[model samples]
Target: MNEETIKNIEDEKFRRLTGVKRSPFEKMLDILREAARLKKAKGGGKNTLILEDRLLRALEYIREYPYLFPYKSKRWGQ
Candidate 1:
């Protein structure tokens, strides 16, 4: 396949995983780069399971309720 076909496939895969159908741009590229960096960091000389557990805990908290921002700021932050 040509480069354009390969990119279309990759973009489709990324969209399926992220649920965001966006055209390829620098921001998306940066995000993919960050993902690779984190993956490599977790894989190299790190306790991967514990890192993943911590990530899951953070995810659970955010999923159950919005986090971080103080209650007062929610009304005014916008």
Candidate 2:
């Protein structure tokens, strides 16, 4: 989910959805932002997804498929 969508969610529900509380999520976002800035300084192309969206997608993947992470899938012949 994006920032606007997340802002409308209740704290408890959001925690349930992402498995993280709002404050910790914001802190994680800040860390991601700093890492992105550092990466940009090293001269890479712009990311297709913004930091917030990327964080959300990561959290979703972790919550949905904890066992599969690092993400080894049959599609990759792993």
Candidate 3:
């Protein structure tokens, strides 16, 4: 299946488990944070590399949806 199909499946599973709906961007952030925690805890394992790769992908997604995440930029005088 494609990425959207996989995401939909995960979304349904998350909703059923938590009884709360979350946007895909929120889900990506949640997953990325968990991966980061796990990577640190696992330390030096190959799984850490995998988690890092996933984290980068999630970061790219965030970059694509900058409006979903607000940052203080010097250029913006924030």
The prediction achieving the highest TM-score against the true structure is 2
By how many angstroms RMSD does model 1 differ from the true structure? Answer: 9.2
Off by over 4 Å in 2: 68-78
Steric overlap count per candidate: 0, 0, 0
Off by over 4 Å in 1: 1-49, 67-78
Q: By TM-score, rank the candidates, best first.
A: 2, 3, 1
Over 1-78, each residue of candidate 3 has an lDDT whose tens digit, in order, gives 334443556767745533345565467657777877887797864553443345445555655666754544545666
lDDT of 1 by residue, 1-78 (tens): 223433556667735533444444335546656886888877856444433234334444554565554664777875
CA RMSD per model (angstroms): 9.2, 4.9, 11.0
Q: With candidate 2 superimposed using the best TM-score fit, by how many Å does residue 62's alpha carbon deviate from the native?
A: 0.7
Using lDDT as the measure, what is the rank order of every candidate, best first? 2, 3, 1
Two-way TM-score contest, 2 vs 3, winner: 2
Model 2, 1-78: lDDT tens per residue? 568998899999988888899999999999988988888899978788877889888887789987785456665776
- How big is the positional error of residue 55 in model 1, measured in Å on the Cα after superposition? 0.7
Q: List the residue pairs that clash in candidate 1.
A: none
Could you tell me how far off, in angstroms, the CA of residue 21 lies in candidate 3 after the best superposition? 13
